[model samples]
Target: MRAQRGLILLLLLLAVFCSTAVSLKCYHCLDPVVSSCNMNSTCSPTQDTCLYAVSGMQVYQQCWKRSDCHTEVIMNLLEVAKVKFRCCQFNLCNKSEGSLGKTALLGTTVLVAILNLCFLSHL
Candidate 1:
C-alpha cells in the first residue's frame, strides 16, 4: 500500500510538471529605420509577435506591427517567434510578424495534444 501511494504521488507530480512546462509566453520584435521621406510621415516600423500556450496541450501564436514614427518613410521589418515541445515534433508551434509595403501585419498559429485521463471527472 505504501509503494502504491508513492507511485500515485510521483505520477501526480509528473503530470503537474508536464502541464506547466508546456504552458509559456514568448515574444519577439523587429525594427528598421527608413529615410528620405516627409517629416510628417511615420518611419521605422516595429513588429511584435507573441505565442501563448493554452489548455488541452494546445499552443497559439499571434503578431502585431506598428510604426516607430521617429522620422519619416516607413520601412520593412521582420520578426518571428517559435515554440517546441517533446509531445510534438520539432518546431511544433511558431509565429511570424513582418511589414508589407506600407502596412503592418499580424499572424497566429496553434498546436494541440489531447490528454485521455478521467482522474478529475468530478471537476
Candidate 2:
C-alpha cells in the first residue's frame, strides 16, 4: 500500500510539472549597435513567443505573442517600411545564432533518470 501511494504521488507530481504553464524566456533588445544581444528576460504570461526582427541595420529581439507575428503588424510596431522578422516559442531563440535545443532534452533526460531510480528502488 505504501509503494502504491508513492507511485501515485510520483505520478501526480509528474502531471503537475507537465501541466504547469511556465512563462516564456526571450532575448530582449532593440536597436542594438552590436550584432548580438546578450540580455535575456522572462516574458509575461500573455507573451507566448520570442521575436527576432530586423529593419535595415537595426535589430530587435524580444518577447512577443504568437498571434502578433504578422508582417504588417511588425512593420507598424517598428515603424519601418521594410522589415524581416521571425517568431519562435522556445527560450532564448531570438539570438543571432547557435542552437540551444539541448536545455529541454537535458531536463527530460534527468527526469527520466530520476523516475527510473524511483521505480528500481521499489523493485
Candidate 3:
C-alpha cells in the first residue's frame, strides 16, 4: 500500500515536470540603448537561437534559428558583417528573465501543495 502511494506521488510529480519543460524562450527589443533591458517570452520551437543585433544606433533582440540567422537581412544598407547575432539553446540564455524555468518550478511547487492538501484532507 505504501509503495503504491509512493508510485502515485511520483507520477504526479512527473506530470508536473513534463508539462512545462520543452518551451523555448528569448529576449525581444527594438530601438534599445545600453541601459535598455529586454524581457524574455516563449519562442517558437523552430527558433533554435537567440539573436542580438546592433546596427548603427539601433538594437534588436530576437529568437532565431541558424538557418534564419544565416539568411541575414541587410537593414539600413549596413553590411552583413556589421550586424551581429548570438544564439543559444538553453532557456532564456539571453538578457531576459528566465521565466520558463521559474514557471516550471512554480508549477511543480503548486502541484505538490495541492497534493499535500488533498492527502491531509483525506486524513
Candidate 4:
C-alpha cells in the first residue's frame, strides 16, 4: 500500500512538472505594438498594432462601436520567415482571461508536485 501511494505521488509530481515547463511564454511571440495600449481604450487597426522581430509576427486589432460597446479585433500570429499566419478574432472579454487561468493552474500544479516530492523524500 505504501509503494502504491508513492507511485501515485510520483506520477502526480511528473505531471505537475510538465505542465509548468510548457507554461513558460515565448518572449519572441509577444506582440510589441498592441501590448502597449490601455486595456479599456478604444483601439483600432491604426491605434492598436503589434510589431515583432520575427518577420510576420505583427498583430492588428481594433475595437469598434457596437450595441454592447465591446471590442472587436483580428489577431494574426504570423511568421513571415516561415510564411505562416495564424489569424483569430475576439469580441468576448473573457478570452485572454481563460488562458491566464490555465497558466496559473499549470503553475500551481507544478508547485504542488515539487512540494509533494520534497515531503515524500523526507518521509
Q: Which candidate number maximizes lDDT? A: 2
For TM-score, candidate 1 versus 2, the one ahead is: 2
Total clashing pairs for each candidate:
0, 0, 0, 2
Order candidates by TM-score, high to low: 2, 3, 4, 1
The segments of candidate 4 whose C-alpha lies over 4 angstroms from its true place after superposition are 1-95
Off by over 4 Å in 3: 1-21, 71-81, 96-123
The best-first sequence of candidates by lDDT reads 2, 3, 4, 1
For residues 68-98, write the lDDT of model 4, one tens digit per residue: 2222212222313332222222222212322
Give the per-residue lDDT digits (tens) of candidate 3, residues 1-117.
Answer: 766676677778677555534566767766546545557777776766666666656666677665665525534333545665455554555553334457557757986897786
lDDT of each: 0.27, 0.79, 0.60, 0.38
Q: Work out the TM-score per prediction.
A: 0.23, 0.64, 0.48, 0.27
lDDT of 2 by residue, 12-74 (tens): 877765444366789998865886678899988888889988888888899998898999999
Which 10 consecutive residues of model 2 have the lowest summed lDDT?
97-106
Pick by lDDT: 2 or 3, better one: 2
Off by over 4 Å in 1: 26-123
